[model samples]
Target: MKLVEVLHMNGGIGDISYANNSLVQRKAILMTKPIIEQAIRDLYCSLLPKNLCIADLGCSSGANTFLVVSELTKTIEKERKKHGFQSPEFHYLFNDLPSNDFNTIFQSLGEFEHDLRKQFGEGFGPCFFSGVSGSFYTRLFSSKSLHFVHSSYSVHWLSQVPNLIEKNKGNIYMSSTSPPSVIKAYYKQYEKDFSIFLKYRSEELMKGGKMVLTFLGRESEDPSSKEGCYIWELLGIALNELVIEGLIEEEKVDSFNIPNYTASPAEVKYLVDKEGSFTINKLETTRVHWNYASNTNNENIYNNGGYNLSRAIRAVAEPLLVSQFDPKLMDLVFQKYEEIVSDCMSKEKTEFINVTVSMTRNN
Candidate 1:
């Protein structure tokens, strides 16, 4: 699959749109807010330039996108209030794949800017917004332009599917049924892509700039662990059900694969160390139930959790699924998806491991 051409969240404000279904990502950001705040707080502010350039990579359209910036501004304000110093002017850039809905974000800018002015008041210096469209794997800024950079739930997406895995059938991602070779292909991809990501950020970031990143992660070094990608396993199961019903061709399903990967914490550290550009300041992991709800009655839990979980997954996977399967079958696919999730949730715990890291660009 051509990831840059096809990979994007479902768009606009419909029931299945990313805007409505990104609670899990939103919660993940909030859960890790402290890491972001500390990264900003400990930036050795004595050396910052007069203009503070900030960038949010993979800043898919929605309220969460601006919330990331708002939090940064708040952290900056907090530092000024606590240390009795003034903050530099802010220049904010929101970036995502070219296929992302920049219109949705730009339309909200008036309100977004107003909110910032209301929160920070008249003293807030020249906070600017520019929508940048491209993959973060490539350098998106001039050298020494950025003081802080943040990306959430994005690095796990590989630039493209591993070629060797073209022979692997049935599974769209790493699974228990995958061969040792398939596992290695994914590992290799993550290692290379992550290395480039670090390298580019290192070049663009001014010396002593901070980067805070988060993505889906696994608990074990073994790539076959479902801890990071069980949701894809369930998605594969859903697609197979469509085949069994004769609604789609088995070969079509076999020809499809998700252009994504989940890295283990060890792999993340290894690439960062090998790249030798950034010093790791904080690397931490957290988990949230796939359903994203911990307390509820069994009936509400089973019904609401399964349905909502399927919707959330749909928002992320629908674009890829439609490219391979009949677009008309999306409704049926997620219907079966909900059933599969309901059955799976009742049988076992369904949670996802998320890794968040903080680093400083070396001098």
Candidate 2:
């Protein structure tokens, strides 16, 4: 499917991660960065020469790309120093959907160009950087070329619409009362997407290459629970408001469903085991706390991460706020959402809001 169509169809309406300025997101990155570096080091140590070709899939625009590269480079440098060997050359490729904001990523890289050059030095090694735009589940690189692959906040996304949902005649995934058929349809799509992801990665990564990935996931095996996902609830509220305002027909809203799915850690393990390409080096889920507003004093929403809540909702909300709702009405809607969610936040009193998993590729 086309990028916009895929996003609209699947409910990937928000940014894949929280807003960049979120302190909670920054903290999560800081906590995760070291682990990622350690994984790269372990993988690099297993390989001779230490020259690594790394790819970050679904690396959307902004500082995230630089964050991964910075961690990888520094780790390699430290390892080189410890071994008393010359630093290996680095080939860093960033991949995302064609519709993503590449200009933003390019601009961020430009800002860091001088610093990167100074660190690597001209003619020091074959350091290559390129942006490859395409679906992660499709061909984007030569076979057996990548040494390490990293994707964060990606892969939970399906490459296409769910088949069962279509066959079910609109009974599933419509509202808070999604039927079993709807849930099955969602899983079916996830299965397909994940299978394609494994196959693609298996083809692109060389023997013994490693992959580290982090995405939104469920802790529970049960699919019907609403505990972990706030995006669906928020979307339901937004659609209800839109219907009440007569901006969109109730039938149209009912026909639409979020095109995203989350798997439990066990379910993810199952997929990997079944695929037989990647081995589970380490798989653990940790709560990631994210905050959108800078004013932490506001007790309405404490943590704002996972299920791509802040970014995904803003993607849909910002455009609708501009085109569909009047300025005053949009302001009121935002306020109402905050008011409704604030009490829940206080009641829950939980801060962390993410699920992270890491893995490796087997020869």
Candidate 3:
């Protein structure tokens, strides 16, 4: 599939939209806030640019999109007040695939700006906002134009599916059944795409500019570990149920693949060193339960976790599923998905491994 055309979070403010189901992503942003704050402070102090240029790559439209904006501005505002320095003018850019819901984000700008001014007061930034539609794998900004860059729950998405995935039949992502060659192909594609991502960002960032990135990754050296792949495995099982019911073609399930990868910390470090553009200041990993209430004593909410998890996954994965399956069958698919996920969660612990790294553009 053409990822640029097919890959995007479900848009708008409806029940199934990403805007409503992105609590998991929001938790990740908050988890990495300390690193982001330090990156912004270091960049601002080093150069003290009057106009601070910031870009949020893979900034899919949602309340989560501006969550990053609030974090950055909050950090800067505190820094300025601490030093008694005048506030800097902020130029913010939000980027995503051209098919993203930029219109929804645009419509909400009035309230967003109003809230920022009211909270930060008169000395607060005159922050300018705009959208750039394109792939981050290619050049998206002028050379040395950006001062601080932030991307969350992105960069794990490959620019395209692996060319050799024909052998990866029966499963949509890396699984225990996948051949050794199929696993290697996934890693190779990630290596190539991530290298280019660093290369382009290095070109766009001013020297000493800082970046904070967070995305899905695996803690185990083994690529097929359940920590990272089980979510998709449960998804694959749901699709197979549809195939058995004759609702979906068996061949379609055999041919379709998710154009995403979860990397290990060792693998990420290897590519960063090989790319030769940035210094890795902090590389840390944290795990988030697929069901946020998994640890709570509330059995009712915990039991309903599967239904909630299904909605969250659907909001993000529906766009890709629709491209290959009948749109009308989506609800049926997730209903099966929720049943399987709820059953699995009751027996085992399931979570997403999030990797957050802070880097500096080397001179």
How do the candidates rank by TM-score, highest first? 3, 1, 2
In model 3, the runs with Cα more than 4 Å from the true position are: 293-299
**Largest lDDT belongs to which candidate?**
3
Give a tens-digit lDDT track for model 1, residues 1-363. Answer: 467877899888788888888888988999999999989878736564567788999998888888899999888877776766666688999989999988889999999889888988756677878989999999999998898999998989998888764456888788888878888888888888899999999999998999999999987887878797688888888889888989988888776777788887788888899999999999989988777732346656656887888898898989888888889999999998888888889899888899998999998
TM-score of 3: 0.97
What is the TM-score (0 to 1) of candidate 2? 0.82
lDDT of each residue in 1-363, candidate 2, tens digit only = 343323421122133223343344345556677668878888778884546799999776555567778878878777777876777888889897766666666766665766776886644455677899888878788999998888776676667546544432222233346667777888888888888898898899988888887776667677655544554565457556756877655665555555567678888888889998888877777665334433245453344422233343454344323333344555455444554455455465433434555666776
Report the lDDT tens digits of candidate 3 across residue range 333-357: 9999999999988888788899988
lDDT of 2 at 341: 55
Q: At residue 108, what lDDT does model 3 achieve?
A: 96
Top-TM-score candidate index? 3
Report the C-alpha displacement of residue 118, candidate 3, in angstroms: 0.7
